[model samples]
Target: METLANLEAFMRSAEHGSFSEAARRLSLTPAAVSRNVAMLERNLGVRLFSRSTRRLTLTEAGETFRHSIGDKLEGLQAAIASVSADGGEPAGTLKVSLPPTFGLNYLMPLLPGFMERYPRIRPEWHFENRPVDLIIEGYDAAIGGGFDLSPGIVARTLAPAHLIAVASPAYMRHRVPPVDPTGLGDLDGIVMRYLRTGRIRHRTMRDAAGREVFAPLRESLVVNEPAAMLEAALLGLGVALLVVADVLSALDDGRLVRLVPRWYCDAGAISLYYPSRTLLPAKTRVFIDWVGDAFKARKLAERFAGSLS
Candidate 1:
């Protein structure tokens, strides 16, 4: 039988299309990955991969082997997960990936409470603006704002995030507030650039007839970080489009004012996502339940109060 280590190396190489990428995923050197593949090839007495200076190609036998081995590997993983599901206090490290601004503003603040409730489960967090590959990177869970659900992942909606347009009180005092989205065309504003794609995105408003329209706002500054953009807006640099949760404190303190009342962009549901499987660990399930309850209660209270106004 081929060793599990060698099999894993081969699978990683196949998935990533490069020995170096596989090694990086496994936290090993390229040479180590190469050696593992070589060992596997020697045991099987066949060339698994044809390597050249420019690329690595799978052999005919290798393609057949991969198709046969993949299901066994998945079955083995599921069996291990089944064994790990034997209930106890959550005692392992849970690696979570999250969007930077939302994590900092909302999730991170709640973590202290979670930690106090479950002391045995240590969380390793990676907060970034870019998209994360949960399976390839071995992440336990991720907090995602977009509705894009990748294959083989389970997603649970956490909250409906609000996207609002705001400007500092100082800026508002000097310039006339735009009565509509079209009026915003002449105003100075800050634009947010996606870190991964480097594309600029702004919120547009719909007219009373329910037609979507955008303004020709000039971007005085473009930034990748949401926090930095918020800070710039606070300093009276220009107007900013940001998640409502991120600027709640500023809004309450009268530092920032909503650009258009009762008119804002709708961001789809934010969700907690994880690998899809028949069974989940007891600890992960408990945490998910707690988070759902907490956010739901908060949202209900907000809705009731909004209706009263």
Candidate 2:
């Protein structure tokens, strides 16, 4: 019988197009993956991959083998996971990815309760600004906005990523409050530069009447991080386009206030992305349910819809 490890190594290497990348996903050294592939080749009596310094291209035989075994491997993995989770008690390392500021502000508070409930599951999470390749990076789940709908992944909408114009009370006191989006040109703006694209993000604002306007920023300060932009606005630097969820407390406590009440930007949906809905492990399933319940309890999506009274 062929070793499961060797078959998995061959499958991952072919999927990732590189032994190093497969190693990363499998949490093994490249040498180990290479050795496993070599052993598999010897056992099969056929060359599976065309080895190159920069890439690993599959041979015809390898492609044929992959097509035959790919689905079977997934089934095997699902079976193993199901068997391991015998009592539906989530008992493994739950790896996840999240956006930095949003995770810190929103999800961090829920961690203690989740840990207390799932004492057998160890949480391993990273806060990143960019979208992570969940399968390639071996994350169980990810929470963020603007992720590509990649193949073999599913997303659940958590909230709308609504943005609005805000400024410190001290900054707005000396200036005329903009009645509409176009009037924003008169004030100094604190704006965000896209970290991935390195381009300045322009604002597209819409009013309650569905009237849309393009408000190009006159940036007095350009920041890449959303947290920094919030801090700058708090220091009375200038008017800023910020996520309502991030500054809800500030707005409620009279530290910051909305500039144009009728106009706000609809960025996208904040979602929870996972590998497969059918083969979801108990840990991820419970976490998803818990997060959804938390959002409902807090009325997060409705309250942070950019219309704060």
Candidate 3:
């Protein structure tokens, strides 16, 4: 039988199309991954990949081997994980991807308690802006909104992703408050430009009564990051539409005031995304439950609602 390390290296290398990328996913060195793949090829007496300086391509035999072992490999890994979990404590690297601001402001706070509970499970977290391909990227889970519902992936919503208009008290002091979206025309707007599209995001407002209003904001200042936009608003630069989770503290402390209190923009939900599997790894299972419990205990769902903002 081939060593699990060699099989894993071969599979990951094939999936990523590069030893370096495979190494990144496996937390191994490029040379180690390459050597393992070479060993696997030698054992099977076949050329698996056609390697070039710039690119790596799979041979015909390699494609056949991958297809034959794909599901089996996954099953083996799951079985090993299950055995490890049942044998003793849950012990493995728990890799996750999270939005930078959301991770820092919300998830990071729960890390200490989690570590205290499960000391054997190591956490590797990547803070990024864009949604990650959880399986392809080798992440155990991802936390964010608006991730595509890829095959074999599932999402558990943590809170509603609602955007509410906010501005600094200093900026709002002399300005007449907007009764609705129409009045926002006079206020300088600190708006967000989608990084991918380079297009200005226009927010449509809805109230509890199911009334809709078109909010036309003057793009006096534009930014891509929510943190930057929040800072810009806090500096009294202009009014901004910010997520409720980010601005909750600011509003509570009087640093920022909500505009058009009755209206909010529905962006969807903040959720935890993970592989949809019959037998989930213990580490991932605990993490999902932990976050859900925290959200319930803190009443974050209620707090995150834009209407409440």
Listed per model in order, the count of residue pairs whose N, CA or C atoms clash below 3 Å is: 0, 0, 0
| lDDT, model 1, position 263 | 54
lDDT of every predicted structure (CA atoms)? 0.74, 0.87, 0.92
- Tens digit per residue, CA lDDT, model 1, 1-309: 877779988988887778998886666799999999999999999999989876678899888899888657756655555576564565566778888877876677778889998888877889876556778776778887663467878888776555667889888887888876677766778888887677987666543345665755578989888889899999998877777767777888998988855455555656788877566654566677767777786673243121111
lDDT (tens digit, per residue) of candidate 2 on 139-199: 8899988888888888999888889998999998878998888998888899989978889
RMSD of every candidate to native, in Å, equals 4.2, 2.7, 1.3
Q: Which stretches of model 1 miss by more than 4 angstroms? A: 1-10, 17-62, 116-120, 195-198, 206-215, 281-287, 300-309
Model 2 RMSD in angstroms:
2.7
Best by TM-score: 3
Clash list (residue pairs), candidate 1: none
Q: 147, model 1: CA deviation in Å?
A: 5.8
TM-score of each: 0.77, 0.87, 0.96
Worst 10 residues of 2 by lDDT: 79-88
Report the lDDT tens digits of candidate 3 across residue range 1-309: 899999999899999899999998888999999999999999999999999998678999999999888778777888788888788877788999998888998999999999999999999999998889988889999999999999989999999999999999999889999999889989999998998899998989999988999899999999889989999999999999889999999999999999999999999999999988767888998999999999999999999999863
